[model samples]
Target: MRISSEEELSGVVRDATGPLCIRGGGTRDIGRPAPGAVIDVSGIAGIRIYEPGALTLVAGAGTPLAEVEAALAAEGQRLAFEPADWRGLLGTEGVPTLGGMVASNASGPRRVQAGACRDALLGVRFVDGAGAIVKNGGRVMKNVTGYDLARLLAGSWGTLGIMTEVSLKVLPAPEAAATLVMTGLDDAQALRAMTAALQSPFDVSGAAHGDIGTLIRVEGFSQSVAYRSGKLAQMLAPFGAVTVERDGESVAALWRDVRDLAPFRGTPGDVWRFSVKPSDAPALVDGLRRAGPVERVLYDWGGGLVWVETAPGRDLRPERLEGHATLMRASTETRARIAPFQPESAPVAAIAAGLRARFDPRGILNPGRMG
Candidate 1:
């Protein structure tokens, strides 16, 4: 259904009895199959409101992320919770939508400090499967209620309902930032270094590691960033020789590539996203190495987030990954044959099912996208 207006969208949903899938920018269009008509929410796109002082920004579901970022940049503020650029990994072109980012709960290296998308979401307005326009939470922080359903729907992969507008918490941009690059540490050593820095008194905003290098980022006032950089460098000294700083342009380029997963782009391989205990990352990477030829592995969120690209034609099975592994980018055959999500416990599965039923009774919204 082409919903040009929010009211019209709600009307269409209210009349539906079977199932309905919500479609936005279609970046993750292939992630799931729609069993019924798709409610193309992209048609209802625009920024409804933005208040810098209030640290709140609300936009239509289809508002492109690029536009939102540009606006926030002009105001010297930004979404405190960094979102990822999935287009690079998917090998697709087009700006991702704000709603899609919230739906996927996508985050970048900054997640280690700034937190995830769900954490920054203040409120949400969406159309449920019953075609009712429901508002949850609020524009301000601190909402006490029976359940925080807004967050519950944030990462539901459009399986729950159609998010029409979202109010997110924003923060002023950091005064300055710097990256400390340490070269030549294996996965295990890198993970240890990152974990240590995360636990330190210095406020390390971002930490990421790849096959060739490990990076630690400090963001704050110029003097503070400088002081923390020196302290973090000393702390990471045990790992190996380290490079103190990266120029602004170079730092921006590096993080852009990091957010885009540049090293894995255009590579003919299976990509997996794993979330495990920070301490478990080393063991998982080592297990992957023993299993087969792994091309590139990027660790983020202080080793909690693992992005791995397997060798061409090699089976990147969860069983071989040794820890929790979710296939984030994969071929159709691979996705169909393997589970894309970590196996949930029975109680968690039951809770997920109940939440699904509450927002999407007919299982029409991007069914199986998360599973």
Candidate 2:
């Protein structure tokens, strides 16, 4: 079912007899076999408002990410969170949409500095299971006291409800950028360097390490960027050979690849996204490598986001690792065999269940998509 208006969507949802798989751009709609109807929201697309001076944007849920980014670029502003375009990594040939980004809480390399999609999110309008339209949060960014359901919709994976419109806070794009590369450092040493850079006053915006090199990006005015990159290099000189790449094609390409996880795109393996502390990332990688062949790995977000590509069917839960891991990429058969999402604790599961019941008592939206 394709819906262009919230009223039509609500009526369809109200009269839905079975399960529903909500789709925005269909880029991430391959999770589970559809139990019943498929509501494609791509028809409901447009940019409702963009206030560059106020740093706010409101758009329909089906608005393509490319369109929004282009609009923001026109105003010399961009989504601070830097959401990832997962087509290459997921092997799905479709444009990404804002609704999908928010649902997944997707973030790219700049997430280390800006934050995930949820951080920029200010408000949302969604349809509950009973077909009622609910709105939360406000256009103006401010501290609010109460249950913030708009933020809750993010990363809920559409189990709660179907988002119709969204409002987000944006920021000005950096004027200049530079990356200091620390080459030839092993995982342990590289993580140490990343931690040092992140803990410093140099304001590292992006930190990622892999087969290429350990990179720490600094973005700002040309003078400030150059000075900070130099200071960061001096601070990290003890680790290994450090080189600087100024803002240009090379530096932009570097971050684009890191943000998109381009290295692991064509590799034949199951990809897992690990959220672990910087101090423990190396140990987790060590344990995983000992278990099976880890085809590729990229440590991003100051080693907090670990993207690992391992041999097919390899278990990603390393010993003594205290963090969540999600199967980001795998065949439908493989994903079904092993739960795609990380399991939650009993108490946490209960809380999630309560939220789901409150928002979607009929259990009609994106059934079984989380698994």
Candidate 3:
């Protein structure tokens, strides 16, 4: 089934007798496979409003992300959260949509500084399972008294509601950007260096460690980028000689690779993602190896986000880690046997169940995707 407008979507929900699997661009295929009739929302697309001066944009949820980015680029602005393109990682083929990005909360490396997709989200329009069209938030930022549905739905993965439209806060594109690279440092040393750089006053925009090397990103006016990148090199001297990539093309390509997990593309293993304390990253990587063979490890967001490629179908959750590990890629049988998302505690799970009951009383939207 396909819906082209808000009214059509609401009608479809009202008529659905069984589960409905919500699909956008089909780029992010995480979690357990949802069993239902596919409701394609790509028809509900187009930019509705864009105020470049105000740094805000409003668009239909199904609008192609590439179109939105092109519009933003023309005005010298961009999504502050730096959302990643997951097609390569998921091996799915389709243009990413704004709604899909919001549903999955597909944030990139810039999240360490700007925040997640939810932070950039100012408002949303969606349809609850009851066939009611609900709107929360607005184009501008302000405090609201009650449940912030805009945020609550951002990363809900379409279980509670189907988003129809979204409004986001944007940022001016940096006049210049550069990455400081350091080689020969192990994960521990890389984490220490990245932590120091992030904690410093240099306003580093990106920090990551992987097979390539340890990288620190700074962006601003040309002079500012030069000064900060040079200073970062000096500060990181103890780790290794830091090479600054000042050419814009090189800097962009490198960060895009990090943002998209380019290194993991086309690899032959199930993928896992972990969210742990920046300091705990190295230990967690070590623990993952002890549990089973891990093909590759990439650290991003100052080590707060860890991506792992390991043997297919092995449960790689570290026994005593402070954070959670999510299975990002696996066979259907493996996903059915192992929970993809972190198992929530009693209280949190109760709250989630209550929210779902309130929004999707019939339990017909994307059933079992989260589990």
Candidate 4:
């Protein structure tokens, strides 16, 4: 079923009897099968408001991400978190939607300096399991109140409820950007450089390392970017071959390549996303290497996020790491045999169950997709 407005969508949801798989653009539906009628919200799309001066945008949940990006580009602004489009990596033809990114809390290379999709989200309008329309937050960027349901729902997929609309804080487009590549450094050394740059006052906006090379990004006025890029290069010179990419266009594409996990795309293996301490990255990679082969490892978020492409059906879950790992891409058989999301501890599991029960009493929304 498809809905063009919240009222129409809410009514259908009120009458739905079986499991409901909420869909938007369908580019990110690679999880375990969500059995039941499909509720496609792509029809409920368009910008409601865009206050360039205020750096805020309110839009329907189903609005295409490309559309929102174009609108922001016209005003010399963009989504501060630098959301990544997963179509190429997921191998799905469907376009990405802003709502889908919010549901997944998608964050790219810039996440280290800016934030995640959840942090930029300011307000949302959604429907409850009982068919009641609920709203939280507003257009303001700051909210220090009671329960933060808006945030709670940001990464909840559609299991919590159907998101009909969202308000996000936007940011001005950087006047210039540069990326410095340091080659030949092993994983540990690359991570050290990333850590050093992120920790310093270089205002580094992006940081990542993989089998190819380590990258450090800076953005701001052309002069400021050049100065910082040079200073950072000097600081990182001890780490091996260093090359500066001062062309804004080329640097943007380079980050996108890293952001989309381009190196691992079309490869024959299962992909995993790991969130660990920046310092723990090398150790975690070493631990995983002990188990067969890790075809590719892409580190982002100053090494906090590690994307791994392992041999098919191989388990790369660190034995005692303080972070979680998700099976980002795998066949249905493989996914069904192994856990998709990280298993929450007993206390955390109980809290999640309570929230799920409270929001979806019938357990009819994306049943078992998260487990």
TM-scores, all candidates, are 0.93, 0.97, 0.99, 0.98
Candidate 3 per-residue C-alpha lDDT over 58-137 given as tens digits, one digit per residue, 9 for 90 to 100: 99999999999999999999998899998788788999999999998989999999999999888999999989999988
User: Candidate 4 — which pairs collide?
Assistant: none
Query: Model 2 TM-score?
Result: 0.97
- What local lDDT score does residue 363 receive in model 2, on the 0 to 100 scale? 86
Model 2, C-alpha of 22: deviation from truth (Å)? 0.9
Q: Tens-digit lDDT track for model 1 on 1-371?
A: 66778899888887876666777877764343456777788877888899999888988888999899999999999887778887768877666898889888888878888989999988888888777898888888886554787798877787787889888899999888889999989888888998899999998888888954898888889889889999888888989988877466677677767777888878888788888888888887787788888888888888898888985445555464445666777776666666677777799899989988887786766677667
Cα lDDT of candidate 1 equals 0.81
- Candidate 2 vs candidate 3, TM-score winner: 3
Error of 4 at 12 (Å): 1.1
Note the residue pairs that clash in candidate 3.
none
Pick by TM-score: 1 or 4, better one: 4
Off by over 4 Å in 2: 29-34, 143-145
Residue pairs with backbone overlap in model 1: 13-131, 14-131
Candidate 1 Cα outliers beyond 4 Å, as residue runs:
17-19, 29-32, 311-323
Worst 10 residues of 1 by lDDT: 312-321
* Candidate RMSDs in order: 2.1, 1.4, 0.9, 1.1
Q: Is candidate 3 or candidate 4 better by TM-score?
A: 3
Candidate 3 structure, TM-score to reference: 0.99
Top lDDT prediction, candidate number: 3
Candidate 4 lDDT tens digits, 106-191: 88888888989899989899887777798888888776555778889987888898899999999999999999998888888888
- What is the per-residue lDDT of model 2 for residues 1-371, given as tens digits with 9 covering 90 to 100? 78999999999999888888888887764344546777888777899999999999999999999999999999999999889888888888767888999998888888888888998989999999888999888777794746798889999888898999999999999899999987889998988899999999999899999987999999988899989999998988889889999947799899899988899887889899999878889888888888878889999998999999987876586544588888888877777777777788899989988888888898888877776
Off by over 4 Å in 4: 143-146
